[model samples]
Target chain A: MKTILESIALTKIFKTGKIEVTAVRDVSLKVPEGEFIAIMGPSGCGKSTLLHLLGGLATPTSGRVLVDGEEISSGKDAVRTDIRRRKIGFVFQRFNLLPTLSAQGNLEIAQEIHRNGSRDRQHVDEILNLLGLEKKTHHKPSELSGGEQQRLAIARAVINRPAILLADEPTGNLDTRNSMVVLKMIQELNRALSQTILMITHNPEAAGIANRLIEMRDGRIVSQQQEGEWNAAEDRMSL
Target chain B: MSSQLILSNVVSRPMRSLATALAVGVEVALILLLVGLSTGMIRENSKRMSGVGADIVLQPPNSSLVLAASTGAMSVKIADLVSGIEGVKAVAPVYLQLNTSGGLGLVWGIDQESFNGITQGFVYREGRGFQGPDDVIVDDIYADARELRLGEEITLMNRSFRIAGIVEHGKGSRLFIPLGTMQRLVGTPGQATMMMIKCHDKSDIPGVKAELEGRLKSYPIFDMSSFAAHLEEANRDFGPIKFFTRTVVFIATLIGFFIIFLSMYTAITERTHEIGILKSLGAPQGYISLLFLKEALVLGGLGFVLGLGLTFGGRFFFQLLMPTLQHQLPPEWLLYTGILALFSASLGALYPALRAARQDPIEALAYE
Candidate 1:
């Protein structure tokens, strides 16, 4: 399968006073087309930082990030922004949708940013229906429930048909039932649309749904296992 | 969507700020209009006074105040001597006399050609110019008030003269006659009451006055330039009133500026997060600035229209309320007001626009 996104020896360091803290240290990863992969790590393990680097939201201190075989991480701000806008879609835990915009309006803004003509109302309807947001199309963010708002954010992130979808703990703010609903929606998008997804989660159960799982500790990946192998490893660890 | 649509969206969100900006624009425009009107009136009056073609007025010694009052005139020989001086353009000896008709009239005796050139072709509204040597050009207002018409005879200073034409003067009414005719009528054939001198250049005034004064050291030569100086002195005497008017306008403009500034600042603060969203969505800083400029433009346009209506309505009311005061509309007033509205609106929006443009997309997004 063709690699939709690849990060080679990616390193990110942040400075606070005289101390330099490494967020992602020499991390290399590949995300192929039509695959659901999850990065699992403890708190402060740089899982979110890795996701941000892959989405072209932040520059890696040293390394290369390639999207569709094109080196996008080394370009100017405008070029990097264009690459992010055209190729990557992001969903955050907080559901960063504009409060003033309706669910439909939020999707329209994404479509506008991509310069897509005559907003794809049919596509929006399909997404809303798929995510069970048909009844919340005209509702503003404040009016929507937390789960509904998160689903709306997911709908907006995918509305532009980006090459890769990145989620940073998308289900972190939802209840157990809503988390299941959101997980099902993610599964449906990955299976039906064949969308390549890289999700960062601290929940092992959330990571179980992925075809592949990577475990990280202290800013470096410690192990990678296939879905069946990860289940077997979890069973052994439980024993 | 077009940039214009985006601008409309931003402006439409804050209706109260827009209204405040409009009010400021109108006040600035009104003040500008009043100043422009006053300046235009002064200029028009000056031009009309210059058209009378007199550089200096030769009056009797110690009779400066009396001559200004038009109560008496000077001797003619002094006028003849002034006319013989080099750089003297032309001199018309004039006499002022109270008629039996109970009206004040000037009996100016001049050569017809010289009179026409000096007056810039004074048209006779109803009759003809002086034809025979004994003919006179009657003042239009004096003729109208006294029911005097062309071909009628009028007795001035106890001498009869035919009224040949009715002349219009914006300032006041006066009668003109030929020098020979005036001598034939008044019986003062060799004497002139006042010398109206037209100098070659305005700069030659003081020198010519000194020379003429040397020749007639006992007489007083009051230059028309002195009348201009008197007008300037009158304006200086009214300095306090003019200063008060200016102070009022300045205070109003400052209030207008603050009103627009505070309103725009508040509106921008409300939209801080929205602006961040726009910037993160790929809107350039210039585009954001354009949004605020468009709002200012709308406010200025609306205010100009409202202010224009109010000014004209106010002028109409004044005309109706005080029938005695002349209240002609000066076009310069409208032009200046429109310009001032544009300037004030732009100035008022500038600082707020810079602040909005400088907002960080990251910080603004995190503001929530």
Candidate 2:
């Protein structure tokens, strides 16, 4: 499979006053086309930072990243923004829907940002239906339940049909039932729609749905296993 | 869809939006009211002066186009010279005094017969014109405003005069007294403020005016058309009032600017996480900036409508209280003020919008 996203020795160091902390150090990874990969680690092990670097949300300190063969890490802000707009969709753990906008409005804003003339009513409806959010189209984020809000967030992220979906703890705030529903929807997106997905999670059951699992420790990937070799025991051990 | 987002945001915070809009509305109302009063007086005075039906007008040298400021410096004998011109049919020499007691007003002193000749006579509602030295003729507006009946006494120049007649308005000054009495009272026995000349033929005015100008080289002279143009230009360049209006406009814009800035700044702070979500959804800086700008514009639009309502309401109430006061709303200033207010609001939102756009997505997402 073709490599859709690649990070070469990615490193990120944050500075506060005179002190510096390395959040991510010398991490290299590649994601193939149409693959669902999960990165599991402890809270401070830089899993989220790695996802941000790959998604063009943050610049690497001493490395490079490319999405779909285009270098995003070294590009100008506008160039990187354009690449992100065209190729990447992000789902956050908090289900960051604009509280003022309805579910449909949230989806429309993403399409508006992407500016694809393909944001026809039919396509928006299709995405809402696919996320089981068709009934809550007019509901604002505060009006929707946890599962529904997360589903709406997912619908907003993929409304423009981006090349890759980067989900950061998408089910972290949901109950077990809602978490399962959200994870199943994500898994369905990857299996049925052939979506390229990279998810970060602390739940082994959530990671079990991915085609591949990568475990991280101290800002570096410590293990990579295929779907058949995925081990919940090893994930807990690494933590 | 973007518009929906903007509308939702504005509607979401109704009180803040209303408060900001009220500030902008007051800004707009301030410009409208102040400018209206000044321009209204100018236009009203100009209209009445022109309606006196003079073919040619002559003012004392160095006198302003503002009739209220006219000084009785020119000799009444200048009207004699003016009457001698070939096309001259009649000449009315009028003395004027500015009254600044209870309110600003102008008192006109006119020779009744000559004044009546130029204006074809006032339409009298009661009594007669300047029947005695102590008699005063007031227009119907002044009569109604002062609630004075015919033969009622009104004080002028510290002397009481009986209201001899109340005539229809639109001729000249609201209060008129005999020229001899006005001249004597002011201690300028031979002087007049201005000379209103009527020509025998309408086509002879230019020739008559030229002749008068040639003869009285030291006086300021004009035909009616030129006189109107001069007043219009003077109105445009009227310094003190212009400065006052501009200062008010500047202050109003500043008020609008600060209010919008604070409103948008607070909104940005509150919506930090939403901005992060938008940025993550690949919204460019321009898009984010435009969102806030559109919201400000919406507020400005609402404020404009509110301002207009306040202005008209203010005018109605003011006129109800002071029946004699004339208030004119210039049509063009409405559009200019609206555009200026919106532009100011956009400028106000600029800093906050740019700050929102420049926010680090990661940091913003982590913002609690």
Candidate 3:
């Protein structure tokens, strides 16, 4: 498999009124095409910050991030924006849907921006159906359940067929049942469509659905396990 | 999609959008109504001046073109001298008094036979003109406005006068009294404000004007064409009224600017997270800015239409309140006012839009 995303010696530091905090230390990682990878850590371990750096949503303090062989970490904002619209999609924990727009409107806006004002209605309907949100396309975010809203958010993310999908705590706010449903859909996307995905979560069960699991501690990747190895490890831990 | 977003945002907050649009509408209506009144008044005055049917107007030196501003400066004897000039057919001595009883109006005191000769005659809508010194011949507009009937007594200049006739408008002042009576009331016996001169043939007007210029040195002589132009020029300046109109325009522009600025600014503050979502979706800065501007454009367009409605409404209201007041709705002015409203709204939204566009996506996303 080809490496679709690569981060080299990534570091991130945040400053507030002369107080500096190191969020992420020098860490390097690579994601291959069609792989489902999850990063697991406790709160405040810089998992989200690392994901942001990889997605080009934030500039690293000292590092380089490459998306599909293009350097995006040091690119201009316009260049980064172009790359993001063309090749990257982001799903946030909060759903981050425009409240004023309906579910279909939310997806259309993303497609509009990605395609520079052109839309593919067929693709949009397909994505809506795939997410099981076809009947609720006209419903506003507020009118949708937690699982439905998150599904709508995911549909919006992949509506334009971006090269890679970055999901930050995709099911953090959902109940166990909904979380399983969302995780299963994500797993199906990777299996059926070969869509590359990077997810961050605190739930080991959610991480269990991924082909690979990377555990972080203090901004460093302390351990990496394949699906079989992580499953066996989880069974032993439960014992 | 952008349009849908803009519409949804505006519809989402009905009261704010409506109030902002109403403010813009009021600004536009003020400009149209003020400009309309002044322009209409000028046109009406010019029409009446032309309707006098005089080939030339001879005024006392230093007298104003506005008859209402003229005093009894020259003696009525000037009419006789001009009538004696070659090609001179008739001359009417007119003593003008500015009446301020009910409103600011001009009262023309005229010599009945000569005034009739120069004007061909007043087109009487009711009765005869000037039956006595205390009888006033009002124009039809004035009669209808005041709800007066023929032979009804009305007080003017602190003196009672009967309505001898209601003549068609556009021949001269709305109220006409005998020249001798006006001269006596003002204590300026034999004095006239100006003389309206007619020529035997229209071709002889230029000759008569030149003759008067040579024969009556230092006196102001204007042929009908120049007189009409002068009236239009005076109307254009309109002195104090012109100043007032400009002041209103300046204030209206500022009001429009501040109203849109505050509205957009508040909207931007409220939509920070939405803006962040757009930014994260790969929306360029210009797109985000354009979204806000399009919203303002919609508001301005609605406001412009509403402004026109308010303008016509105001015109009708004023017509009922003051019948003699004239109003004109020039199409060019309507277009300019529409442009002005849109420009003010766009200008007002510029800062907020750019500010919203420049927001950091990360910080904006984190905004609670």
- The per-prediction tally of clashing pairs is 2, 0, 0
Measured with C-alpha atoms, the lDDT of residue A213 in candidate 2 is 93
TM-score for each candidate, following the candidate numbering: 0.59, 0.94, 0.92
Error of 1 at B158 (Å): 37
DockQ of each: 0.13, 0.80, 0.77
Model 1 misses residue B238 by how many Å?
18
- Candidate whose DockQ is highest: 2
Q: What are the per-residue Cα lDDT tens digits for candidate 1 across B1-368?
A: 33333444445565674577558655855575455444434443334445576787676665433222344445666656787887787776655433444444345676566545445557667787778886878766557666788889987666677988887754212677776676656666655556667788888888888888888787667677566555434442356547965786767566666666676687688778766655544444565676676666666666778776766676667446532223344576567666666666667778897888767655665566
Q: Compute the lDDT of residue A26 as modeled in candidate 2.
A: 96
Quote the lDDT for A106 in model 2: 85
lDDT of each: 0.70, 0.87, 0.89
Q: Which residues of candidate 2, in runs, are more than 4 Å off?
A: A116-118, A233-239, B157-160
lDDT of 2 by residue, A1-239 (tens): 99999999999999999999898989988899999999999989999999999999888888999899999897466777888999999999999888888888888878878984235777888988888888888888899999999998888777777788999999999998898889888888898888999999998888888889999998999999988786563443211
Off by over 4 Å in 1: A116-137, A232-239, B1-16, B19-36, B39-364
TM-score for candidate 1, residues paired by index: 0.59
Runs in model 3 lying further than 4 Å from the true structure = A231-239, B66-72, B125-127, B131-135, B149-164, B184-188, B217-220
The alpha-carbon RMSD values of the candidates against the true structure, listed in the order shown, are 11.9, 2.7, 2.9
